[model samples]
Target: MSQKLTLEQIQNFEGKYPKQLWHLFMVEMWERFCFYGMRGVLAIFMVDQLGLTDANSNLKYGAIQAFVYAFTFVGGIFADKILGFKQSLIFGGLFMIFGNLLIGINPKEFFYIGITLSIIGTGFFKPNISSMVGMLYKDNDARRDAGFSLFYSGINIGALLGGILCVHLGKTYGWSYAFLAAGVVMILGVAMFLKFKNELGPIGDSPLLNIAPKTRKLRELGVLIGSLLCIPFIYMMIQNTDYTDIFMYTIGPLAVVYFIYQLIKIPDSNAKSKFLAAFILIAFSILFFAIFEQAGGSLALFAKGNIHPSVFGISMDPNVVNNGANSLFVIIFAPILGLIWIWLSKKNKEPNTVIKFGLGFLFLAGGYYIFYTMRFFSDAQGLSSLEVFSLAYLVVTISELCLSPIGLSMVTKLSPKHLGGMMMGLWFLASAYGQYIGGKMGASMSVTKENATLIDKMLAYTGGYKELALYSLIAGLILILVSPLIRKLMREVK
Candidate 1:
């Protein structure tokens, strides 16, 4: 393995960021393309092609998203202790490709199989890559935040393409075509990572501890076999919303217990404080994501059924506008925000992580409030102007800018170096929890094609949005009020 790049070597190199960062950025971009592309149409596909009700489709979508993220915790264990990050990521990407292929071939017959593979694959892929990015920099590097922001922009670049192209193909031709496109992009991503493996060098190499080769190989095999064994369990969860609910309930409390256990094991008060701060931040983040994630389920449905298709005579697909516009805004804003943070840091005026999170909640409230305004202006047909609705997405993108990228960086900084992979997975697990809650929220606002009049659907959805707006605003204020205490817990973490 190439010698690990030192801070000196990294500094001496004349680049703004490592070449390896760009390589990983491209790989993650394509991975997001595959994931988001399929996501853009998944709920609609279930309702339209698989002939499920809106409620069933939303629940299933939530289950799929939940499991995909939940499995990342398992993947983190394998990466940290068994397979190593590189192997886990490659295997994850391959599984994702095959999953999409299976769905493209015949989603009606192979939907469960496809979803199961994608979930396992994402488990292996997602956390490891982000972990690897964290590995690229030293613990206290000021450039770390900016690097993550650039990396986040890459994710959205793929998301922009996926949302636009996948929705267009699915709406214009067929859902199968969209799945096929996702698979194709996933294959490209896998190939790119494999070809450029050397660029990543020893960043994600096996741990230094000596274990017998035979034992290591056996553990690797066990990870693979164990993942396959969980497929049936995942399949059941997808079919039965109750199981998904039960899993969410079990996992959230269990994660808290596990974190507390880790805290007790740590002897250093300073280190312990960082973990406490991280735990607090993680908890607050769940509220933001739970509300924000309605974008893929409830918000998408509202866009499809309630928003006018044309704005000023230009026709657009609702899925494309709803999903793609968020990414487009992120692409436009991420760098600018990154620079703002850097400027603030120079002035020693940067907001603490907790305050950033508070801002996230505030912006989330703003986004939902914008959507809530549709209750006033929507027509008897329940159609609102696309311009007004699209503005909501733009607002939410600002919230994401505050929360998502910073959350990734915080996981790296606050967690023990040895537990970095698992902590990253925990970050995603929080997202899994949010997704399940979001699913429930979306399901509560369901508007089935058969039963609901336009006005009825509008009232149900808009009422939900209004409630969410009020709740998020209150949550933001609470976070801001308590942030000074959380800042003390963070100690020198900033």
Candidate 2:
């Protein structure tokens, strides 16, 4: 019998990444395929199949996405305290599989129920995987960022395939096939994890190993049962956006209070300062996501009604472009960006994480400005150029590369090991707020007139984009101005 690899042994491996990283990468890739596929179809499915207005669909989409992210915070706490990352991930994956299967069976009747399960599943599956990745590297490893960048690519690759396939299947074949495909991929992800999880050794083992085995089992069972019990309540909240509003308002403040309590409990002042810095970054990310997340809501509608069906004179589905183009761009560019970061670091010229985040907002502003300019390029019937739309996604991908993966790496660097899952949850909880705000913004831009033309929609959506651009620019400037203070708080992390 072979001895399992210890955490130190895994962390000290003499290379850019551990072999186990690839296994986790593959698992995450398949899970993302399931996730992004469903995300691509949600708003369009509501509008076309469920007979929702654009405004209502956008609001519902926001509510759904918000729930998905908010639950990650809850999932993280549970994983940290009760199930450990491995069991939580497996439990989450199983629920996700079941959720998609249910939707596949009857999308209209069981939509909310399936979605509720998926939201809970994603909350559990998402944060733990990222935290596990963080455990693969030593605290000060120079390659941690690069490893995360590679992991980030796996997510985009899944998104790219899922985005293209799900929308194409849902549109051409049937919604069942599209959703079933998501379930199938999720199963593959879980299977892959089961096959290779031993490579993680003790990293994700239960924290309660010292306790009585029966007691531990009972606790874990309690969490699983508790999660299932919440499904009905979640279904109710999701079906009503007013309920979503109440839940979001209440949950966010409570999470903040919990975070502050945890912060106060940490014994080291330096660690506390880093936690504060992480919190600030997480807060700013809410604004970034609120603007960036327009891709799923208003942008989906814009693609459906107001965009040309050709890019560079080749015919294609505009919704497919809207859904998958950013992921494709990220796939192509993430490695190159990783190399650029390494090169800059070698020369002592790389910007700190705070500066990178601020630069992301600047790029985001530029992308939205391009989206705004699409109004000028519209033809008589209000259809705009797909080439220009692709250009905006290219810019937005750069912004995402700057912030999203780096932010993941940053949270791991800032947090104490025991709190890793909770902090990661907090990071995603910020995204939940962003999704909530984004839905409202998309709703605001939805043309409400009964006989509204494509031209009216183009005008309304583009005008909203212009406002978003101005707000993004102001945010970027503010972040840059405050970078020094944030950098001081970060101390030695960078």
| Candidate 1 accuracy as TM-score | 0.96
Q: Indicate which candidate wins on TM-score.
A: 2
lDDT of 1 by residue, 147-225 (tens): 7888999788998899889888888998788989999999999999988877665667766337888887787788889
Compute each candidate's TM-score over C-alphas: 0.96, 0.99
Cα lDDT of model 2 overall? Answer: 0.93
lDDT of 2 by residue, 414-467 (tens): 999999999999999999999999999999999998999999999999999999
Off by over 4 Å in 2: none
Best-matching candidate per lDDT: 2
The 10-residue segment with the lowest total lDDT in model 2: 8-17
